[model samples]
Target: MKFKVVEKFTSINGEGPLAGQLVVFIRFAGCNLNCSYCDTKWANKDNVCYDFMTSNDIYKYIKSTEIRNVTLTGGEPLLQEGIIELLELLSKDRSLHVEIETNGSIPLNEFGHIENPPSFTMDYKLPCSNMEDKMDLNNFHGLSPRDTVKFVCGTMEDVQKSKLIIDTYELSDKTNVYISPVFGQIDLEKIVGFMVYNKMNGINLQIQLHKIIWDQNKRGV
Candidate 1:
């Protein structure tokens, strides 16, 4: 099976729990949601260049990197049909720790039936994203403790939306939850204080480490 690819390269995890860890990122092309502040629009659906390679070809690239952790990111990797086959092949290499970053709109059950499931980094879009209606709350229910739910907030409204999602689903009991301010949009200190004053529990503040280290607008990390 083959898939459309935007780019692939070695970079630090850049977000969530694994931030700062070395990783090989395979960025698939295409996404259903078009968030207002999306930084990687260049990698979105319209710009995809087909990378017609077998799963083995991708595995070979990973093997050559000498990096054991692989991040299957996107333009929403789940939008591709061959993703399951690719994950199956990657799972054979027991030494590799696979991570899948998703937008948390599509149902995880659609992809989670694979023999070996990768650790998931699911982003729950807030109201400011403009794609909030696309979210399927059922997606959050499918997460295992190995997964994390992230909220990318740009305003107090966004934070309130995130809090509502967290409380509505009782997400804290299932897995790690994180709230991150949109890079350069909201003041970090304000977000931290808001979280504190609201008594929001079981949530960690995340920052885009890659943006801090490299050009914020650059692609391929």
Candidate 2:
């Protein structure tokens, strides 16, 4: 099946548990929700030029890179049709460690039964994002240690809400949970203080390393 591919490039995993690791990123176009801090807004616009590549073509491109880590990002990669086929094709390659960076509004259950399913780095859009109501809480039930639930906080309210979600779901017991500040919007120290005060044992704090390493507005990493 063909997919709308905005860009494909080799880069280090900028966020999540795989940070700093070499990866091949396949960025698809379009999204259902618009977060206040979305960096890839350019990719989500309807007129963005993109290539139409089949699952086999994408699989071959990843093989050419010879990079073991593959990150399927987006404008919400899950919004694409025929994504399951692509995931299945990628899973057949034993050498690849696939990860999908998903916006949390989508359901994860459909993806769970895939053989050797790709790990997910999901966003739990905090209130500051203005898209919190769109999140599908059921997705939390499908997480495992191989997955990550990330909260991008811009205020103390957002941090408190993140803590409530974490404790309510016991997300740390089910998966890797991370809290990061909205780039340039909140002080990192504030998030640290909340974590320290709450004794957030299993949560990790991260920054978008790519933004620090390169022009934050630059594409293709």
Candidate 1 residue-wise lDDT, 155-200, digit = tens? 9889888888888888888998999888999888888888899898
- Please report how far candidate 2 places residue 115 from its true position, in Å: 1.2
What does candidate 2's lDDT look like per residue over 1-221, in tens digits? 89999999999998999999999999999999999889999999999999999999999899999899999999999999989999998888878999999999999999888888999999999999999999999999989999999999988899999999999999999999999888888888878888899999989999999999999899999
| lDDT: worst 10-residue window of model 1 | 45-54
lDDT, candidates in the order shown: 0.86, 0.93
lDDT of 2 at 71: 97
Least accurate 10 contiguous residues by lDDT in model 2: 181-190
Candidate 2 positional error at 218, Å? 1.0
**Which ranges of candidate 2 are over 4 A from the true structure?**
none
Residue 73 local lDDT, model 1? 86
At residue 64, what lDDT does model 1 achieve? 98
